[model samples]
Target: MRSALIVWGGWNGHDPEECAAIYRRWLHEDGYSVRVETDLQVFADPAIHELSLIIPIYTMSKIDKEPLANLVKAIESGVGLAGHHGGMSDAFRDAVDYQFVVGGQWVAHPGNIIDYTVDVTKPEDPIMQGIPASFPYTSEQYYMHMDPSVEVLATTTFSGQHAAWTKGVVMPVVWKRLYGAGKVFHSTLGHQAKEFENPQMATILRRGINWAARAEA
Candidate 1:
């Protein structure tokens, strides 16, 4: 049986606990033996290397050097990593190593909590296979600084209403990349657990997690 770890704790404003529950349910339904943790120390635990995937719902928090290094090493050794929104990209703001593993960092969210559209960039990709070409969404439109080599599966266009200079700019919303032998998947959706109620958002994330698991890789 495949094992997965979900470490969730950090800004509670993102509802980490609730998001963790959702992820746990999904992992269970998918037949993974899921373990959840609320501390960053789990990153340092050697057990991480034995897991098939790691899902972090931690946002805007500090992770110690030793733990961060071990986490990176585990992933590089073939463990998968996956998460959405700030929980993944916005965590460990100062850690370049974490950013390298995640493939992107959340820099800004113009017009916070507003309506926007998500455009499927690679519908043929398994993570986005049945998702619509474009779907209306209501949440923060993330403005991220991303790794150039990551494969983008979905994107969103800024209207320039909030940041005029950003108007006409397209940004990646969902992406997957390889970190050594690991498969990393992320989506700049789900500002909170509620967003998961959206079928498209939920479906895309579910598929992304499955795609990122070590078994799939």
Candidate 2:
């Protein structure tokens, strides 16, 4: 059976613990053996190298350098990495290697949280096929520092919420990247547990997990 190691917990302000639980339940129901943990050191376990996927439900936490390094190595050797919003992107701010592998960093959500529309740029991708080309949701409108290597699959344009100079900006909301021998998928949604209950989001996330586990090149 495929295994997923979920590491959840960090600033409660981000509600990662609750979000992690939501994912644990989702994956369990989907028939994957899932192990949930709050610590970051599990990356050091040689056994972690055997897992098919690793989900980081952690946001803005200081990770031990050793384990962080080990995680990079593990994924480099072929382990899928997947997560959404701050839980994945905001986990290790000071670790360049972490950001290097993950492919982006959260910068700001200019007008705080607001309703926005997501446009699927890659409708043929399995994760996006059933999803409508455009949909509206009330959540954080993320401004990210994206990597050039990532294939952006979805984007959201700033909806004129503020009279700032950046009003017409469009940013990636979901993307995928091949890092070393592993795969990485990130969606800038899922700021709250309620968001995960969206059928579209659930299907997108499920496909992302499967995509990340694909055989390495």
Candidate 3:
């Protein structure tokens, strides 16, 4: 069976533990031998190099050099990485290298917990297959600083209702990219575990995880 590691714990505001549980369940259902950890120290374990995927639910957390280096090295050597919202995008704000690996960093949420629409931009991509062309969602529509190289899968338009200057701006809602031999998947949704209860949001996240896991083998 494929193996995966879920490292969760950082800002409780994101309900990392709850989110990790949800991911653990789905990963197991998908036939992975899943391991869950609250401590970041596990990133340095020799076994990290053998995992098929890494799911990090850590938000706004600090990481020391040793473990962070190990995590990065593992991904670059073909381990897949997947995450969502502040838990991933906004994690390790002080670590620019981490942000680079993620392909984007969460900067702001203009209308925090407001209604918005996510427009699918790459319906043909397997990660987005079967999802609707567009859907309305209620959450923080993330405003991110993105890496230009990422393959964008979905986007949201800023109505400028909350931030006037952002009116009519289109921002990526979901994306996938590569860091060396590894596949990296990210979505700017899921402020909390409840967001995944939305069928569309949950499907997208699950599909993204599957896509990332296959990047290596």
Candidate 4:
């Protein structure tokens, strides 16, 4: 059976535990055997490489060197990685190595929380099929520094209503990339667990996770 590990903890404001539960339920529904962990040490285990997928819900925490190394190694060994929002991009503030594997780093949300639109630039992509070209959304509009190598699936344009200088800037909302032999998927949606209640956000995320879980351990 395909298995997945969810290591969730860190800033509680993002509702890491709550978000983890959501992922756990979704993975279970998809027939994946899911394991949940609150400790970062789980990443240090060599057995991590035996799983088919890893979903990180940690936010604003520092991971130790040994565990970070092993985590990277597990992904490079063909284990899949998928995550959303700050849980993945903003999870490790100081670890550039983690960012390297994930393919992007969270910089700012220009406007803390506001109404925005998610434009599906690649609606034809499997992860995005059936989602509209654009839809109304309300959350943090993430402005990230992304790797050029990532395949962007969706994006949002800053109206500059909150930050004037960013008025017309287009920012990536969802993307996928390769890390060594691993498949990496990410979305900037879901400020908290509640956002998953939105069908569009939830559908994109679900398909992204399933798509990224292509490689077997």
Best by TM-score: 1
Residues 58-84, model 3: lDDT tens digits: 999799888889999988989999989
Best by lDDT: 1
Which candidate, 1 or 2, would have the higher TM-score against the true structure?
Answer: 1
Q: Mind giving the per-residue lDDT tens digits that candidate 2 earns over 80-150?
A: 99989999988889989999999999988877778789999999988799799999877888889989889
Each model's RMSD to truth, in Å? 1.1, 1.8, 1.1, 0.9
Better of 1 and 3 by TM-score: 1
- State model 2's lDDT: 0.85
TM-score of each: 0.98, 0.94, 0.97, 0.98
**Which is superior by TM-score, 1 or 4?**
1
Clashes of each: 0, 0, 0, 0
| Candidates by lDDT, descending order | 1, 3, 4, 2
Can you list the residue pairs that collide in candidate 4? none
Give all candidates' CA lDDT scores: 0.94, 0.85, 0.92, 0.92
Which scores better on lDDT, 1 or 3? 1
**Which digits, one per residue and each the tens of the lDDT, describe model 1 over residues 15-121?**
99999999999999999999999989989999899899999999998999999999999999999999999999999999999999999999999889999999999
lDDT for 120 in candidate 3 is: 99
Q: Lowest summed-lDDT stretch of 10 residues in model 3?
A: 208-217
Model 3 bad stretches (over 4 Å): 214-217
Error of 4 at 122 (Å): 0.8
